[model samples]
Target: MIRIMERIALDDDELHEDFMRSSGAGGQNVNKVETAVQLRFDVRGSPNLPEGVRGRLERLAGRRLTKDGVLVLTAQRFRTQERNRADALERLVEMVREAAVPPPPPRRPTRPTLGSKKRRLEGKRIRGDVKAMRGRVEGD
Candidate 1:
């Protein structure tokens, strides 16, 4: 089981991992070894996550999420498959941890204060007067 937060723990079975060949910097070993790890988690179908967390996870995943609400994370930063696998799982745990936090309250709409409004209008009037003074004098 993976603990995402104080209240959230995910079973190992919830995650699916696939290993594939890693590109770059491995030389001869890179072609023969499948060091890259791809981790998939079904956010929509998970029984472990709260509804709010599920929704936030989907939103935060963005392009990494599929239409079916599966989140795909790839980790290939390490040369060894074990390291990459751990990295992928770590990323998934971090994402779930982030999702566990409640979203901030929605911003309340507010109108400008009377004093601020008055100041804005006063500034505009001053700007207008300055521009008006640039015009040619009628009597000249």
Candidate 2:
């Protein structure tokens, strides 16, 4: 099981990984060995994820998720396949963990504090005075 949040765990089968030749930096080995990793998770069809969590994941996935609801992560920063694979999993875990939390509740309307009201009125008065100063001088 893949641990996301404290109570949330994703099944191993829900994730798919593929490896391909990594480009740049490693020279000959980079050309021969498959060091890049691609990880895909089907957020919509997964039985491991709850409906609410899946919905949140879809919204949070942004460009990583495909139209069919597959979340794809590519890891090519590392030279080795194992390290790249680990990096991919870490990213997936972080994304799901972030998706697990609900957004904060909206704030309720409240009356301004007495001090705040006074400060606002003072600011308005100052602005008014500045504007009044710009008016044409009387009889001049």
Candidate 3:
């Protein structure tokens, strides 16, 4: 089981891992060994995740989320299969952690203060005066 938050814990069975050949570096080893790890988790189907977190996670997953609501994470940073697998799982945990936090309250709409409105008008008038001064001077 993985603990996402104080109240949220994900079952070990929730994660699915597949191995594939890694690209770049490792030369011959890269060609022969499957070092990359693909980790998948069902965001919508997971009973461990709260509805709020699930929705947030789905949005956060973006392109990583499939039509079936599975979140896919690929790890190929490390050359070893074990390290790549751990990296994938770590990324999944981090993503879930981000989703667990509650969103900030919506900002309240506020009207400009009377002083501020007056100041804005004053600035505009000053700018207009500056422009007016640049116009052709009348016979003085």
CA RMSD of all predictions: 3.1, 3.7, 2.4
Q: After superposition, how far is residue 128 of candidate 2 from its true place, in Å?
A: 10
The lDDT, on a scale of 0 to 1, for candidate 3 is: 0.94
State every prediction's TM-score relative to the real structure: 0.77, 0.80, 0.82
Write candidate 1's Cα lDDT for 54-76 as tens digits.
99999999999999999999999
Query: What residue pairs clash in candidate 3, if any at all?
Result: none
Give lDDT per model, in order.
0.93, 0.91, 0.94
Candidates sorted by TM-score, descending order? 3, 2, 1
Runs with alpha carbons beyond 4 Å of true place in candidate 2: 113-115, 119-140
**Number of clashing pairs, model 3?**
0
